[model samples]
Target chain A: MAAGAKLDPGKVRGEFPLLAGKRGKGRLVYLDSAATTQKPERVIAAEARFYRESNANVHRGLYDLAGRATEAYEGCRRRVAAFLGADPRGVVITRNATAALNLAALGSARLLGRGDEILVTVMEHHANLVPWIQVAKRTGAALKHIPLDRMGRLDLEALPGLLGPRTRIAALSAASNVLGTIPPLAEIARRAREAGALVVVDAAQAAGRLPLSFEKTGADLLAFSAHKCYGPMGLGFLVGKPEVLERLEPLETGGEMIEAVHMDRASWAEVPRRFEAGTPNVAAAAAFPPALDLLEEIGLDRVRRHEMELTEYALERLSSLEGLEILGPANPEERVGLVSFHDPLVHPHDLATFLDGEGVAVRAGHHCAQPLHRILGIPSSLRASFGIYTVKEDVDALVEGIGKARRYFQG
Target chain B: MNLDDLYRDVVMDHYKNPRGREPLERVDIHAEGANPSCGDEVGLDLQVEEGRILKVGVRGRGCAVSTASGSILAEMVEGLTLEEAGRVARRMKGALKGEVRPGEIDMGDLEALTGVRKFPVRIKCALLPWVTLLEALLEKEKET
Candidate 1:
């Protein structure tokens, strides 16, 4: 496919009903995809169909309705594994990326000890960082943070020095939410492996925007949220090697996960079922396949291409404005899907408010990466993130909005 | 309900050029207030003489609504009796809580921030400076 060719912006935009709604006598320009993607019609319909037709508890029921629900639920697991280039046996559905990371952290508590280290990058969302921090506090393990370079990308060169024999786990995001920089996961995984530390990759931002192959990425564990990938909320997946999962203890223990329960104790079921303690989000899980199909139909490569183009255009336009400082990688090639910038005279909240008045939606505040913000020496920034449905015109509107914000403050 | 009203020209002017930006020297009372949700912070200093209000100053960093509200408040409380300043603070609180409309605010400069009543998320930002003032006054009352 030609660059940005496969996805027809009009057709893709039509698939999202929220886009059709009127906003301030103009079309809604959604630039907050990094927070959560707007769901397509197919995904929404699939969720409705699940509730309308295939609504039943899985695994426990033996009736036709139950069997169908179980099949659909398990089928989603297989599709998610295939999407990440992993085996279905290794995939377990969780609430969201945060829960997935916590599952891994809590399960691995057995392996950690006092003075043992868990390393994470400064650019990690609290979802990835806080769990490890909690794990360290609980297990008496030392929490170490790998430093980010000036561009807000992790420095892989410093990995060796941070990793040691006591390093038990290394968690990092595949893409920085604020910077939009894709990190070198494979190299970091390799180094972590050499140090006998397991690598956990938070692909919440990377999954739908980029092509992710868990096998090739070399991460022992991977987590991503379906809501961020144009699917329904309350559904996410944790993918890992089967053997690694076998070593884990379930963070939650209840009906679905237990094979048999006695008065005293219980034996758990298999890998996925064991991890899924209670009723899974059946409707949301059923909704995921359609979202995956939609992404495949448009093609991820084309989606990435369109986003990169828009990001480059935004960077070029935004940087030219006086008093505007673009954060993250200056080179568009190093970033993906999003751009964050600061207007020295205007706080990000003011900018967001101004843009919201103009019918443009973006994110402000720490973007849940306070350490990175501190390192960048700014309180917060305004971020505009793009997705498959985004068009060049949307970037134009955003650029115009930024100009308006600057003028509003300056004049 | 239009949140843009919160960003009025008068509000922006105070935000851009806040009065009492400097600290009061030999300050009798100092107190800090922070909006944890958005990390907006403000520090207020008071130079009190007996029961009458002598001088009030504020220094802080935050969104326009916050800084402007701080400037308006610093200008309002100075030269008023301590009891009168307390009444103004109560009225400001009532305005923010939606108990009083923008027109009901008798304090001239403080009325500019009345637009903040619409944006619920920004209410805390607008109140951060006033919260610091209250803290400083309470601390001074205890000292005496």
Candidate 2:
């Protein structure tokens, strides 16, 4: 199948209300899906319908509305667990990936001690990195970063040397947000396990784009955000082994996350409920199933195949331009559904501004991975991240925009 | 959102051919400023002679807005008294704040960066070098 052919780009485009509106007399080519995927009308309507017709706090009242709300909320948990190929007892819904990672870090802090180390890759998002850093600082544990190779791929050969008796947890991203390189998680997890360390995978960039089976990956905990997967914002999941979840203390405590309350002390609820404190985003939770359904309808293998072709096509076209330096692996198979490049003649901000004028929306900046950018020896770069909905036409428009920018400057 | 507006002819020229691009190995005042938000950073070195900016040089990595802003500031500040440099910095700040027009900025190459006011996210990039210069000046002031 051709790129964007299996999925009707026009029909899919119409599903997003934002795309229906014109910004500057031009079609909106959203290349910043890595930042946040555009929500479909189905997802939006699902959320709105819940609020308009069935609005009630869950797990509180015995009325019909409350019963329906509680069922819907718990039903989302089961759907999310199945989506991650996780057991229902192991899934905990949080505000976002950042919150999920923090919950794991805070809960695991009890097991760590002074001089104990947490191994994380340099390519991790701040959400993953900062929490570990904070945990290390608070516990007097050491944090060691696994460096990437020249092509932005993780150096797994050095894993044996890095992992030691002091290594407690190894956190890594399934796919990099800036460079788009997908690390070899299965191999890394095996190495980490051999060293007696638990593996934490940040699947925020991989969940919807790739096949994510928590069981096969052999990770103790995996965190992912719904916003990046065309689902509603402020909803994400942390899939952990049952034993791992049982060991972690709840990061936040309040209404609904309790088993028994005495005058002075209280016992927390079960695995998923123990982690979810107070009221949750019921509408967002309700919207997730449809988003996953859309992905399922298109099939993830086809999505991956389509994105790879488009990204390869983009890389081939963008690299042909003068003074352009593409970051990350040169081959498409070594990376995910994105490309980050720097123009020697034009700053990324300038390139992005010109692209924006042409109705192309590519992200230009450090992309929240400043440390990795510094390691790569660039200040910032322009990133064109693709998704299931991206097409070859979008790549052509991007190339055209780059050409315009180069000509406007060099001419 | 016009790239031309942000990358004015003069700004691009300075970015292409920046003045004071070398390092001042024997500089007296040196400081670095980093904007962790967008990863724009600058290291500045200044030689103060009799309470005046006798010489200035900067080195770092950032966007065209930042590199050009540094070049423009470097070119305009040389030979000016420390007080005058402070005044110029204030005027540039006012320009960035939209308190003054690009035409009112009399600091030669400095006016090229007046277009940065249009891109709010890039204002920090344009100011990275100037902030480093300010910090260096303040540190020099304290020494005397």
Candidate 3:
């Protein structure tokens, strides 16, 4: 349905019931999709359907209910693999992006040796950054950084020096959660691979906003959360290459992942199951397919175009406002559909409160990238992000609310 | 979430022109407190003599509720006996938790931030500096 790309954002807003209503003094303008996306009714209905019609432990019982559950869960895995252009056998689902990233980090600890290095960037959200730090500490690997340039972009010029032979792994984010800066991952992945380092990309902010192909990016492992993509929470996935998957140790052990269990010892199941030990999030797994279906129906290329247009509009509007300093790249094309700004006259907390009074929702504080904020010389900032439902009116409302907040505080 | 209730004229004035936005030259106690969720931080420096606070100062970055409350706290604690300051800190905490009645603490400018009690999640912002000051005082007592 590529012809459906003609649908207007304002018209499609009705699909998300939360965006259809008014709050406080005006219509609710949700600009915090980077934090978590609003679930479509179909996605919510899918989860409820599984719980009501087919409720049973997957891969456990030989009965019809168990068979249905197993079929649905594994079917979603194939869908996710197809969506990412990855092999289904390599897809290991987890609780969320944090769990997925931790699985990659903790599971890949054996791959690193003493005096090796893990190259990272300062723009990573704690989920991506902290796990690598723990992995380095456990493996005697030194944690190194690809520092940001003057414009907050990753310093690719320094990549060659950082990705030397000692670099065992290079962990990077496809898009920064705070700055909205998308790194040149294909190039970075090439360098890491040439240096014989494994590449792990955190797609937490990039997955739904932009198109991603696991093979094309050349990442050995990738992690992303489903809740940020109009799906249910408590669901995320990590996909690794077959060879890399074979080397990863399972982070957890128990019920569902044992191949053969004596009273004393056991053998792990398969690649994905070995990593996923507990009872799977059966309903969540079944529900996640509808989100992919919706995205495919809308077409990801169209989604990216819609977001880029809005981001350009938002950047121009925010730039025209006095005292509002936008962070990240100067070009809207170089960033995602999110803008983090600092207003010299008003604190972010106060600005967010004032915006709430006007029925506008924006994220305040560090957005879990505290170190990035500190590097930018701000304690925290205000961020307004976009989704398929966002329209010109939302950005216009945010600009107006910001003007009011500045006036109220300065007066 | 009404802005008027949370940000009174007094609170805004203190925030815009904080009383003790600089560090004290010679202080007996010093401590730093941070609100990791919001990334608000405050550093408290106090010079105590015998059983009284001689001078107190606060400096750092944070929201209006926190910065204004911190400035007001510096003014209120100065020249007060350590015991009296402790009593005032307890009253402020009680008011923020909605456990104390009006006029119970007699905090003057500090009362402007009592509106934060309505927003339970933000009460920690208003309480950060005062709690940090108390921490310095307690540490000094332990040392002595």
Best by lDDT: 3
Off by over 4 Å in 2: A1-5, B22-26, B99-112
lDDT tens per residue, model 2, A154-270: 987788789999999999999999888988889889989988999999998888888779987879999998999999999988999988888887889888899999989999998
TM-score of each: 0.94, 0.93, 0.97
Q: Which ten residues in a row have the lowest lDDT in candidate 3 chain A?
A: A1-10
Stretches > 4 Å off in candidate 3: A1-7, B101-104
Per-candidate local distance difference test = 0.85, 0.85, 0.88
Candidate 2 docking category? medium
Query: TM-score of candidate 1's chain B against its reference?
Result: 0.90
**What is the C-alpha lDDT profile of model 3 across A96-154, one tens digit per residue?**
99999999899989988899999999899999989998999898999988989999899
Clashing pairs in 3: none
By the DockQ metric, which is better: model 1 or model 3?
3
Q: Candidate 2 DockQ score?
A: 0.55
Q: Say which docking band candidate 1 falls in.
A: acceptable
Tens digits of lDDT, candidate 1, A40-77: 99999999999899999988788999998998899899
Candidate 1's displacement at residue A131, Å, is: 1.2
